[model samples]
Target chain A: MNDVYIVSAGMTKFRKHNYDEDFRLMVKRAFDYALNDADITHKDMDGSVSAYFSDHIQGQLIAGAMTNDYIGLATKPSKRIEGGGATGGLAFQAGYEEIASGNMETCAVYGFESMSHLNTWKGNDVIALGSDSNFDYPLGGFYTAYYALMATRHMHEFGTTPEQMAMVSVKNHGNAMHNPFAQSPMKITVDDVLKSPMVATPLTMLDISLMSDGAACVILASEERAKSLCKNPVKIRAIGSSSDTMRLSDRPFGKVPLLPNESKDDYKNLKYPGVHSFRAGRIAAKMAYERANINDPLKEIDFAELYDSYTSAEIQAYEDLGFCKYGEGGKFIEKGYSEINNKLPVNPEGGLIASGHAIGATGIMQAVYAFWQLQHSVKKHLKNGKLQVENAKRGVIHSHAGTGAYETVSILER
Target chain B: MKNDVKGTEIYKTDPLIKRWDYSLSYTHSYAQDSEFFKALGRNVLLGSYCKQCNYKYGTYRKYCMYCGSETADIELPLKGKIHTFTTCYYSGEPFMNDVPYTLILVEFEGIDSLFMSRLINKNNTKISIGMGVMAKFKSLQKFDVNDVYFIPEL
Candidate 1:
C-alpha cells in the first residue's frame, strides 16, 4: 500500500578482516556510515532487521540481536532473517515490509559475517550443512563441487565452454579494479582465469566468489519519510522472492516459468531447469518484472547487481533473469553484452565473484552498490566513476542461496 | 565445589583473540526415511513413490514432496547413467585426503528424478554424461549416504 525507498546505503570494504574487526564492530562501522550518509542518527530509526549466515562463523548465536544492540538499537523492535547466502537480501525485503505495511516509517537493515575464524575446509563444511545434511553432506562435496556439477551440465547441454565461464571472471575481476570496496580486483585475461589453480573440473579458483569478512547496511523509509529525510532517494520499486527444493536432487522438471518478454515456444524443446538452470531464479525474476512493469529486462533495466557467487552461476542468472534466452548465456557473455558499457551492464560493483561474498552481507552489499548507482554517487563512493552506467535510472539486484533453492530479485528506480 | 575451569588458549596476540574449540555429535533419528539408510546396508537403494499421486522420488523421501501424501519405499535399480558429474580437487574435512574424487547424479530408466552418489571409478576410466554406472555397497556400513557408491559398469 505504500512505496518504499532506500534513503542511505553503506558497507565495509569486503576482504578477510583477520580478526581486526569482529562482526559486531563491522556492522557498527557500516551502520554508522549509513546513518551519517542519511544525515540521521539511531534516534530517527523505527525498527531494525539483521542478517548473517552461520553462528559457527560468528562463534555466537542470535547475532542479529547482538548486532542490533551493538548498533544502538537494543530496545527497538528488531527481527533476524537468514536464508543462507540470501540472508542480507531477505533482510532488505523484510525491512521493505516494515515501511510498506506502515509498521515503521524508517527502518534499518544491516548484515554481517565473520568467516575467517574457521579454516577453509572446516568453514566449507559448515556452509555445506545448509544442504540436506542427511543426504548430500556425506558425499563430502563442498558447495563449489555442487555448483561445478551444474556448470558441467550447462556446458554439456548448451555447449557452454570453460573459456566463456573464464571470460566472466575476467570481466568481473577487471571491473573490480575501480571498485575500492572490492576484495579481489584484477586486470587479467581469460587465460588467467583458466590457468588459476583448479578447485573443481571446469571451474578454477578464479571463477569463485571470495569468502570474506564484511558488513553492509541500508536505511529504508516510506515515500513521505524518504522525501523529508533525504534529498535524493532511490525507490524500492518492486521486490519478489521465490524458492525451490533444498536438495538439488529434488528439483522436478516442469514448464519454464515465462517472463513477460518470453513465450512457451521459446523452451518447448528444452527440459526446463534440468540442473542446468535455476527454476527459482526464473520465477523470482518473473514475479519482480511483472510487478515492476518491466517487459524486456535486458533492454529496460540500466544495470544489475547479480549474485555471482560463481562465474558460471552469473551466466545462469543472465538466462534465468531473461537477459538472454536459456542456452544463450555463454554466447551472451562472449559478445560482451554485460560489459560496463554494453547492452545491459551487470555487476558493475564487481559482483560477489570479483567483490566479495560475506554470506549474510552479500545481498545487502548488492543493494548498497545498486543504491549508489541509482543515486548517481559512484564517483563519490568509489575511486573511479568509469563503472557507472550513463543516465542510469533503474536496476535489479539478485540474491541466491543453496543449489538454486532460495532466490530473491528486487527492482530499484532512481 | 573446587574451581576446575581452564583458561581459553590465546589464539592471536595482536588481535587479542582467544581460541574456543567445541564439537557436537548429534544423535539424530532418520524417522520415516530410516528404511532408505537401512536398505543401503543390504546393498540396495530405496527410493519412494507417493501412495496417492504415484510420483517417484529418486532420492529417498518419507512423504511425497509434491502431493504431501505418505510414500511407499521401493527398491531402485542398481545400474543408472550419469546425468552429470564433477571432479572435486578440494573438499570438506572428511574428504580432504580424498581430493580429486568424482561425484555424479545418476539418472535411471523410467525414473523422473536423479540420485546423487560418489563415483569410485575403480578402473580409472574417463567419466562422462550418459555413461553407465553400477551401484556398489560397503560391507561395513556407516548407515550414511556414502555407504553406497557407483562404479563404471564396464
Candidate 2:
C-alpha cells in the first residue's frame, strides 16, 4: 500500500473565546484552515471524523454531529473517537487506518474544545466524571492529584526535586515565548516556578498544562494526491498507542521499555510494572523508523514535538522515548538538549506546556508542526519568522492525556 | 472581634412561579463509578468482561468492547490489593472537607482487575496498592449510597 500523507494541517490560535462561541464555530475555523492548507474543498473526495474528549466538554453527546454539521461532513461517514487524553491521537489513528486499509482516499480529523464551557476546576471535575465514578471521583482524586502522587514517588526514590519539576515549567514557558499559539507566553525562571503558588505539593500551578479553548484540523491523503495537490506532503512514518490502568496508582513501575517486570522500582509511582507513556513512543518510533528504514533514531530525527501536559512528563518522556537516558531528562533540559538549536528541538510549537492543552487537538497539532518541519526545513522557516526545527527531515509528535494513563506517539517524515 | 469579609448579593424576583418542591440527594464518594462497588453491597465485586476477547476491562465502558467481542459483566470476589492512591486536600463536595481522604484504584487479588474505592481501616495507615483489602459496607444510616469501602480484612 502507498504511504499515508498529511497534505494539509492548520489550527486556530488556542485561546478561549466566549462560551457563546461553541464547538461548531471553532471547527468551522479549523476546517477552513485545513482545507486551505490541503488546497481542497469540502466537496473533495473521501470521509471525515472529529476527535475529542466530549464527556469533559459540553455534556452534549455525539459531539461529532456538531462538527459534521458545521463542516457538512455529516453525510460522509463520520463518527467521534476517544481514548481519554489520547483521543486526538486515537482519532488520527482511525483516520490513518481508514487510508491504510484502503477505505478512503482522504480524511480530515477535526479536534475542538471549549474549556471556558466549564472552568478549569469544573472541567477537571468533568474529566474525572467518566472515570470509575464509584471509586475514584468520589475520593476527589482527579488528574492533578494523580500526577501529584507520581511526583511524590519520583521524589521519594529518584531524588527528582520539585525544583527540577519546576524547571519543566520554566523551560516550557521559555519555549512558549517563541510560539504564536501558546496561551501563556512569558519568560519565567526556575525561581519563578518554585516561588509560584503550589496547586499541589511538588506540583506548582506552573507545573500543569492549562485548559484553554481551541480547535485544530489535519487533512491526510495518499502520497500521490498529496504530492500533486499540496505544497508539501509529510509522510506518516509510524503511529503508536498504548493504555495502562485508570490511575497511576494501579500500574506497576517498569524499568525497561515495553519490557515489564524488570528488577528496579525507581518509578514506582506507576501501577503497571512495565508500561509508560514514553513506551508508546518507543514502539511508535521503532515501528516508524523500521517502516522508514532508518537506524540511530536519535541522530536521524532532527526535531520533536513532545506532549508536554506537565513539565515533569516531558522530562520523563525524554528518557522513556530514548531521546535521553533515564534520570537525564532533568539534565538534558538543563543543558538545553531540547532547546530549538540544541541536539534535538522539542515542542518547537510550544508543546502542551507552552501552548494550552486543547485535549484531542494537541496530538495532531504537534504532528502538524512536524509536518511543517519535515516538508519545510526549519532553517528556511526560522529565517522567515516562523518557529522552525532546523534541517528537520523527520520528527516525532508525542501526546498523553490524564497523566500517563493514555498516550499517543506519532512520527512524521518528508 | 474578627469580622468575616463578604460580598454583597443581588436578589430579584422572576415573573414565573413554581408550585412543586422536591428533595433529591446527590451523593459524592469518589469511590464507585459503576455497579462494581454497589456489587460490594451484595458481597460481589463486579468487573466488566469483554465477550469478544474475554479480557476484563479495569475501567468501565458503556459498550462491552475489546478487539472485537462485546463486553459482559463479571462478578469478582470482594478481596483486592490496594494498588496506588492519592489523598485529596480539596473536595468538590462539602462533605469531604471534614477529612482529607484517600482515593485508591485497587487491583483485586487473584484477578488482574481494578476497582476504584476508598481505603478505609479501623485505624489510619499509609495507603499503597499492595495493601490487601476486602469489601466493607457501612450501615444504611451512614451509607450515603457511597459508604462502602475497602476495610482491613481483619
Candidate 3:
C-alpha cells in the first residue's frame, strides 16, 4: 500500500455562528485556509471528500457533491461520508484510501456542522437520530441518557465517583484556556462542575460537550507527492475503524461484577470469560497500534487527542485505549496524568468540551491539532502562556460516536 | 501590491428564512417486533429465544447477535431485577414535561438481555440496582410501545 501524509490542516474557531454564516461558508473558509497552509492552489487537487453528520439540519441531500460544487471542485470525483460524530475520521480514511490506491495524487478532506440554526431541543432531537431507533429512541433516550447509563454502571462497578468525573471537566476547561480557538476557556473547579445543573443523573451540564458550529479541513498526499511539495509532512502511520452493536443494551457489560480493590491479577483471573469490555475502542486501538507498529501506547505514543464528547467518555477512553488498566480510568484522571505538561498530555486543544463538538468537524479538528502538535507549531495557537510538549514525535487521535457503536483511531508520526 | 488584486469583500444582508413542516410515517414490519408488540397489547411480555446460542433476549430481536440465527418469540416472566437505572433530570419535548422521571434497565429472570422501562408508582420509593421489579401495562387505550411500565415488586 502507498504511504499517505497530511500536507496541511486547517480549522475554524469553534463557536456558534451568525445567521448569515452557513455550512457552505464554513467549508469555504476551512478549504481556503488548508490550501494556503499547503501552499497549493485548488487546481492542484485531484479529488475531495466532505464529512457532515446530518443533511436533515442542512435541508439538503448528497451534501458532499453540493460542497464540491460550492467550492468550485465540481468536476472531481467527490463523495460524502457520515458515521455520526466519527464522520470526519471516516472521511480522512476515505481520502487516504483514494490516494493509496493510486486513484488520486492529492485529496482534500473537509468536515463541517452548522447546528446553530435550530434550537437546543430541536438540535438534540436531530442528533439523537444516531441512536437505535427501534430500541433506544422509542424510550426517549438521548445521548446524555445513554452515556449516563454507562456512567452509572461504571460507578457501581468500579467505585468511580462523580468528583472524579468532574475533575475531567475542570482539567479540560483549564486546558482550553490556552487554546485560542476554544469556544469557552473559563477556568472551572470540580465544585462548579458538581454544582452545575444536572442534565442526566451523574452528568451535570458541565460534563457534556458544547454543541457548536464549525469546520475543519486537511490535505492528504501520497508519500512521493508529499516529499516534493511539503517540507514537514506528517505521515499517516496507521488508521483503524471498528463498530459495536447499535443498541446500548446489546453491548457487553462484563459478566463478573466489579469488586472493590480488585487487583490487575485478580481482574485477569476472576474476569468473566467471553465478555469483551469496551469492545469497539479496544479493537480499533489494537488494530491501529498493530499497523502503526506501536506496542505500548502509553510509553511509545508521545501525545494524544481523544474524543472526549463527555467527561466520562474520556475516562472510559483512558482504560479502553490501554493507557491504563480497566477500572483505573477514574484514578488516572484524578492523578493529573493527562494534563498538558504531564508525561502524556491528552487533548491540549481543550477537546470537544472546550473546543466544542461540531459533530463532523470534531474528528478532523483532532487530526489538525495532532498535526500542529507533531509539527511543533502549536505555540502560536496557544493563548495563555501554555507550554507545548517538548520534542513530541508521535500522537494518536480517537473519535467515537453512538455510545461506542462507531470508533476510529488513527496514529500520526512526524 | 493591492492595486491590481481585489481585496476581500464582506457582504451583509438579512438572511432569507424558509420553514418546512414535514412528518415522515413508516409501517415498520419486523416479524419479531410485530409479534412482541401484539403480545404487549395483551399485557404479555414476549422475549426472543435464540436456541443456537442459548441466549434469551428480553427485548425482542429478530436475529441472534451472537450466533447469527433466527430467534423464536417466547413468553418471558413478568418479574425482573433492576440491572441499572437513571433518573433523567432533563430531556427534549414529549419527555421534557416529565422531567425527574426514573428510567430503569431491568434484567428479567433467565434472559441474557436487559429491558428498559419507566418506573411507575415510584411514590418517593428510593430505587437501587438489584431491586426486584415487575412489568405493569397501561390501560389498553392504544397499542403504543409506551404501554408498559415496571413497578417495584411487592
DockQ for all models: 0.75, 0.16, 0.38
TM-score of chain B, candidates 1 onward in order:
0.89, 0.62, 0.80
TM-score per prediction, in order, is 0.97, 0.76, 0.92
lDDT of 1 by residue, A186-231 (tens): 9999998999999977799999998898999999999998998999
Interface RMSD list for the candidates? 1.0, 6.1, 1.9
lDDT against true structure, model 3: 0.80
- What are the clashing pairs of model 3? none
lDDT of 1: 0.90
lDDT of 2 by residue, A1-414 (tens): 657888887777777543445678778787787787567988774888787786536556778877787777767888788777777877888888888888888888888777766656656667766554544555563676666655555454445677777767776787767666678787888888888766544567788788878888888888777777687788887776665555443343344553221234644454333222345545554555556665665677788888777776777777666676555677777777787777987877677877777786777677666777787743342334356766678787776666555666777887
Per-residue lDDT over B20-107 for candidate 1, one digit per residue giving the tens place of the 0 to 100 score: 7889899988877789999988889999888688688899988887778888888889999999998888888878998878999999
Segments of candidate 3 deviating more than 4 angstroms? A253-266, A269-277, A382-387, B1-22, B25-32, B121-125
lDDT of each: 0.90, 0.66, 0.80
True contacts kept of each: 0.80, 0.17, 0.42
The deviation in Å at residue A403 for candidate 3 is 0.9
Between candidates 1 and 2, name the one with more favorable TM-score: 1
